[model samples]
Target: MDKSLNTEQVSVEPQEKRAAKPVDRPFLAMLGMLIGGFVGMLSETSLNIALPSLIAELHVSIGTMQWLVTGYMLVIGIVLPMSSLLQRIFSTRSLILFALCDFIVGAVISAVAPNFAILLIGRMIQGIATGLILPLMFTVATLIFPPYKLGAAMGMIGLVIMFAPAVGPTLAGMILGLLSWHWIFWLFIPFLVVAFILAAKFLPNVGDISKPKIDWLSIILSAIGFGGLVAGVNLASDSGWGSPAVIGTLVVSLLVLAWYIRRQLASKTPILNFRVFKKSQFTTGSILVMLDFAIILSSMYLLPMFWQNGLAIPVALTGIVMLPGGIVNAIVSAVAGRFSDTISTKLLTTLGFGITIVGLILLLLASSTSPMWYVILAHIVIMMGVPLAMSPAQTFGLGALDQQTSGDGSTIMNTFQQIIGAMATAIATSLLAFGSSAAGNVSHRIAFTNGVHVGLWFTLIVAIAALLLSLTIKGQKWA
Candidate 1:
């Protein structure tokens, strides 16, 4: 079906044509979005520590269980490009309420899931909610808060974005220790209910709803293109890269994505505006952001496995190990947002990548016998760099855009994050498998460490590339 409404269905009042009043209660509205977003992001990494448990209990391979992470991100990648169109078609309040409901339903399905397939279905459902809520959080912030206050609002959002992932492992670790993994799903229900009530009671309709013709072909292409690409990468770890399933899907995904980009460039009301790339700073910022997410996700995915499986650390201890770094990441992200006001994006991003590289190098030193303290320190260092780079790079990129296209800019940025994250996690998993297999006679612990080192080396290279790209990020004055 066409995703747009018929003319008769769209009642556009003159008042609707005017801009919305900055929200009547910005804090309440922001609070609801933040809480919902925290739940969504917490779900993202919560499974990292639980992967080993799920694999054994569900009789799945590591590659198969990783889907709990990869599948969630893949769904988000597909849904994010459509968020701008969704925002135009629905009021902010209506959308947030629906997303919350969607999440609650998904959580229920996940908590009671009987099999791996059923659990995955539930995760994807939750991903759909996340895809809607994440972009809307920013879109509503821009709509309700004036420019001066925008920085602080975004910093708060960044705090949730960074902190949630940071804390997810620890939280999941703690929960699994005391209760079943099912409680992880149940634990968030109360918070989700609170967020839903707050949103229903307080969220203002912040944006005008307009009837934009949806591109059915674009939607299909996006779904197949991104889904096929991520699926192909994910399967590569199981089937070799040259396997027909892998090569065929990757080739098809690339061609479809090319066609999709061309269609977007030619359309007047594209679902995701490709024109935003015409801005040099936005382009550079987009690349840095994508690489930054890839690095963060890859590390997050690999580290827990390394600790739990490779080093034989208990799940709870592994989570405790990462706790300090998560806290550090959250604090640094907030401070980095403030620093962006006084610092150049170039300087901040450069330093961020530089620190990330050091963190990766330290991670490379981890082996079966390495001290736990060293691993913790390395995680903390890498976590510090991400916020230092991410907050400013994101701000500068979207800041470079005119107010008219900032929503599109946010969609593109968030879309790439999930897409790249899916790819990164897939590739890291593949590397882990490949490295482990190549180790031949080594013990599984050493073999896994071998794979982790390979993955870390690859992430280190991406960070260096991001560092180089950060150097090219010209000031906004030039834009």
Candidate 2:
């Protein structure tokens, strides 16, 4: 975006020395991306707060209103697999500016829509924008920054990812308390508009852009594979996992995904490159990322319900209580990023998962008699551990790639993160339902707490797996 450095070219090689240009404006580009990412993550979590209000105002049943969230996720899942292809077709500046504007348009449309159909359409459009921009943010940062500084820059991006959801519900609750549900969409416009303006003037091209031919077969398979997989998992939380819809969708999705994987491996120009997995650090790091995200997402899903039901905490108060943990998460994500460059990331990841295990133990030990501070402390500890492990894992994975496949690597990581998040939440939901059902003759609150413990135990096991994987990293540097 900064035309002043037109003659200066930055190499894709992380270790390659730059022929240092004085006028390059990479931070401005990153700032715009950070803003765009914040808006996207905020859009993700904030809307749940407004769902009940929107249902009442729109005269829709509870099930229909949830489509606003589920459909948004579905569309995003479909689009994410095509991100590398999209990057090849559009320049960084052009692509990001378009996504920012698209987000703004969707926000405006959702804010003014008078019916459920239009609102759903608007939310889906916003979904597409996020699917395009999120991977690009990672890809751009990977290509632009040198390896030495890249860790801190990735940590800053991690802040946007972790902090937005942390505060989004609180912000939305406060907003809805005073204004109409429409204000939620209205607020997104300003943030995204600022992102668009900054990106237009400063975002520079990173990778070589080639207008590759669209592979329609790959696109269709991916949509059905990813979209169906996400949809099935999402529905499982409400519809029992045994429900025909869930079972059928999951079966069809897995089969299609198998076919899709085979096609990608054989294709010369695959829409989603599966080849990135050949790099062991990238594969190992990605598994760590998925495991960490699942732990975080499942805990986040279960903890609020645990508080509200078992401890009799109010819904609003639960968000307030969670605020401290979010703050700690933001700080740790930033610090961990900088530390990754100087420390052994494998050690950092091992430490992070270790801390997470302690937090989970604290949480499992607490019950109806546990003090509120204990609950908050447990959350804060997990928050610290997750991003501490997550950021470095992310850095380690992307650092393994050459510039040619950075977009593919980023897209692959992002797409898996989403599916893992959904699956974790759904699995937690099922465990709670089953565990509570088995808590024979107990009080409702006690029964639910029993279910919560079961879920926490599952996450604890995953955290241990991640810890073991971190050890296998052997302190090896990727590049």
Candidate 3:
């Protein structure tokens, strides 16, 4: 073996001493993670494309169809925090199998459903499965790979996760154009099957199974609290912020969250180790990540709409235009992850946000008649910066914890990303909804511009928040 490979194996040996067998190839493990991550993200993005078809087929209103989007996101957001416990209790094999089964069942149900409500039920089921799979991918990848190689591995996977979904609409559009929307659901089954077989055959069966007993109360409290919080945020996007329904949900969510915190602090075997926040790097890193994701994801969700609806481009062309940005961002994210081990995450993260802010500023100057290349260039800059920021920020965030607690920390970071994505979705959707109605005074072109202007400003605000938070990250290297 090469000396470097030998050194890595030697370092990993102690960590895997308890395993029945060493993982066959860490790269293979990463491939499985990449597949799972790709599929999980694709499920959401493809469904957005397929939604119009489903609505026409089922005779549902747009408002009812909105639930399909909200329901899936809400479930995933709520269940992500519970993944820490799942990682502790279930072996990688069992968890992967469980999540795979969940995706299959939900996909089948949605495919065959007679009504919108039934399809939603299936979507909720699928969301939970996806929720579990998301963090598990990171946990398994982290466990199998040495720290030094984690960034490259995670970056590659992150690229697939981020860019694969950009192709979702194209794929879904092709499928919808050729066959029924049900084929979109059918499309996922084969991928899930492959992921399942690979996971069962090659994935390790390890976990943080040291806890003596499960803490049921903590699980319930966390679920309800996070669920209510996401729901309140989602409701606010559709309804007014001051609405009774939103206020009531927010209040209940806060109360439940408080109780959950108290319970975790007091419990003998807590689901997550809240004490990890003591590390200043971890604290600041998490906030930076949350804000970064909120801005980036919201922009991703909103931009294609501007192109398709505002700019009069076809959906296929929109997907094609968006592809460059997605691929660029994904590549940058992986490169930044590798560089993070040597450079300061603070610098990389700040640079990432700075680039993104410039992109948004450029985007603000755009009109419906603006050249497509300008829009593409704006996104490319943002994408370039993201790679600099995302992986390194995550590595820094999770690196704060001791090895034994890194799993918990990883769960927190993933959960935070999911929540930010969910919250951003709610906020962006609400802004679009409200802005469309409020822009009646402007000409159609200017009205479209105004809506995007408002939304981009929100994204800019999120980017600035991320930039400010990035300043707090310690200039430290992690092995």
lDDT of every predicted structure (CA atoms): 0.87, 0.81, 0.74
Question: What TM-score would each prediction reach against the true structure?
Answer: 0.94, 0.88, 0.89
Q: Give the clashing residue pairs of candidate 2, or none.
A: 1-202, 1-203, 1-204
- What tens digits encode model 1's per-residue C-alpha lDDT throughout 295-369? 988889999999987899998888889899999998998788777777778888899999999999999988989
Question: What are the per-residue Cα lDDT tens digits for candidate 2 across 310-410?
Answer: 88775567667877888898889879888888877788899999999999999999898789999999999998898889888988898898777877998
lDDT rank order = 1, 2, 3
The TM-score measured for candidate 2 stands at 0.88
Give lDDT for model 1.
0.87
Q: Write the per-residue lDDT of candidate 3 for residues 174-204, one digit (tens) a residue.
A: 6755677777788888988888887777777
Model 1 spans > 4 angstroms off: 1-21, 476-479
TM-score (C-alpha) between model 1 and the true structure? 0.94
Worst 10 residues of 1 by lDDT: 12-21
How far residue 292's Cα lies from its native spot in candidate 2, in Å, is: 1.7
Q: What is the lDDT of residue 270 in candidate 1?
A: 92
